[model samples]
Target: MSYLSQITSPTLLIDEKICRANIKRMSDKAARHDMKLVPHWKTAQSHIIGDWAKEYGIKEVTASSIKMAEYLCGQGWDNIHIAFPFNTLEIPKLNELAKTQSLSVQVINPVTAQKLVDGLTEKVGFFIEIDAGYGRTGVHVSDFGLIEEILLTAKKSDKLYFKGFYLHAGHSYYMPDIPALYEQTRDALGMLKAKYQSEYPELVTRTGDTPGCAVMEDFGDIDEMGPGNFVFFDLMQANLGGCEKSEIAVALAVPVVDINRDRGEILVHGGGVHLAKDVLVDENGNKNFGEIVYLNEYGWTIPDHEDRSYLKSISQEHGIVKASKSLLNSVQIGDLLGVLPVHSCMTADCMGAYLSLDGKWIDHAEGCH
Candidate 1:
């Protein structure tokens, strides 16, 4: 039997070849621009994937939480940066990890900085998270006083040293096209560089957002890039023009459970519990749970008539695919159907682990086992 025959329920399938290709492309881009490519591990959340990244000469990486950092550290990652805001409650864990590894954490305000200073027993590096118009976290770009205060506190602490500024530029993901995305990235980075490069000439400026990093050609004066979602570009990334459809590396293989010829619908065992609740709205404002694809002995292929062959909606344990009558006729109740996720990060987190095409179970942070 084939791998598809073995998958009985919702299984996340990772194409190793496609994944390495995506990694190489981004690595080469960072090399050409002369910036550090400290990829965010929050996407793959796998030590095996981190080893693959090492093959391309990536020595440092970024994580979303202290637990993830500890996991990666145990896997022999010496230089790890926790990209999320500094949580004072995790100070003991942070100090313990810092004793063995070159650890860094992000600080958004003076209060957080002071807390780190008071709680940290081991020396740690601090990066001020700058709000590059994302409005999610970080101090605003114009808030120079708060930024300075955070920096000064870090400088005064023997256990903490100022690393630099970092931004996510998440708003770039909402742009209508690549040009708008690129422009927003440039403006954001330029604003930060212009404001602080003179005062802190040695501080590194780090930025990470899949949409901006994948689409933008010019990364004006950025010292580091930390994009994570580029590892497994999704339907949303492709739709947003960040990458080609062929570059998407992971897909959820679901077992077809029913077919409705009258309604042009196909039901699968996969749903929000497997793919997450993230939706991608099309140009016509049609909300999609994911993009459906046809599975065969060779592999999977995206449908030519995607508008009629894509995932329409999903619930806790069921996914409704609205496809053409001819397409719906081709699927059977026991067949394995593939779905490219709207957001690969959320989908991977939901699935907990991955099943590689070569017939191996790849362990992640939240493994199903």
Candidate 2:
């Protein structure tokens, strides 16, 4: 009887020790750079993991939605920043949270700022978003005047305190190499903070996205850092040069339900419902949905496997193996196949809870993002 033997099929397994190490690594990175380490709770939404981050001196946390801020507030940690552009519908909850604790919300436009001024009953910190090449939400980096105008308008109300600017170089996650990622981080932050000449020159220029914060050492003029995915570095991170394969802390343990030897495929019980549809295509257009590893008699084992040792392609619920015809024949119906997800964030969201490699159960405490 082994750790894998006791677990059920399609269970989300997290290597506890590795998960701890991953949190420390990101916290250490922020400490060394002399920036505030606002660990984003959007990645591993487990309260247990959040406590681990707090033990590592993570006083501030960032979240992707107002609901997450509520979830964290329920757990008694107050200093939080809802990193996404403010959702107008959540104003009532935002007002409620601000009364009890410190809350900073992101605003991408003047319309949102005006709304904040109108409905915000209590004072709140605001981080003006800058679209520094990601093209997601923020105001364009060239339009600093627009940011100044919004700040000025908010100033008249006295209900909002200007925290600083925030930009997420999310496009950097698509890079094919580390050098490209590092350059993207440096260039994006450099252009955004090129004119920080106010008396409070420390205007909290920040960027989130784990690839830039984890791989690059030259993110210029960043006052605060938010790197969430490094807590469970996925295959996409490794493939994109954020970290090595060894840094991946979580993997899905899917049981092989069938073996299609005629077509050279191994069908696993885990589907897109468990792993999500996050596939990564290489430069030559080779698509890899997930990485497969062998889990042996010991805990969730990797068996000293290399990158391409197991299967790769995935469907909504069925994972298609890339193994040789002979290897496919060796797989049994009840065999458990350890799968590394292409994107940990999506995969973990699909999985409601986790089964530790050591046969312990750790419930995912955070609510849906």
Model 1, position 93, has a per-residue lDDT of: 93
lDDT per model, in order?
0.85, 0.78
Compared with the true structure, what per-residue lDDT tens digits does model 2 show for residues 1-369?
A: 467777667888888788889888888888888888887878787777787778888888888888777777755565789999999898998999888878999987888888888888998988888776678788887787888778777877778888878878788875446456556556656755566545335567788888878877866667788888999999888877788777788888888778877766788887788889888876798778887766765544443443354446666777777765445656788888888888898888888788777677776744556
**TM-scores of the candidates in the order shown:** 0.94, 0.90
- Give candidate 1 regions above 4 Å deviation: 177-201, 306-308, 367-369
Superposed on all Cα atoms, the candidates' RMSDs to the truth, in angstroms, are 2.2, 2.6
Per-candidate clashes come to: 0, 2
- lDDT digits (tens) for residues 1-369 of candidate 1: 556766888999988888999999999999999988999999999989988988987888889999888878866765799999888889999989898899999999888888988888999988888785679998887788998888888776899987788888888777566566556556766776777778777778888898888988888778899999999999888887888878999999998899988888999899999999999877799889988877765567876654447788999999999877667767788888889999999999999889887667887787411
lDDT of 2: 0.78
For candidate 1, list the clashing residue pairs, or say none.
none
Worst 10 residues of 2 by lDDT: 298-307
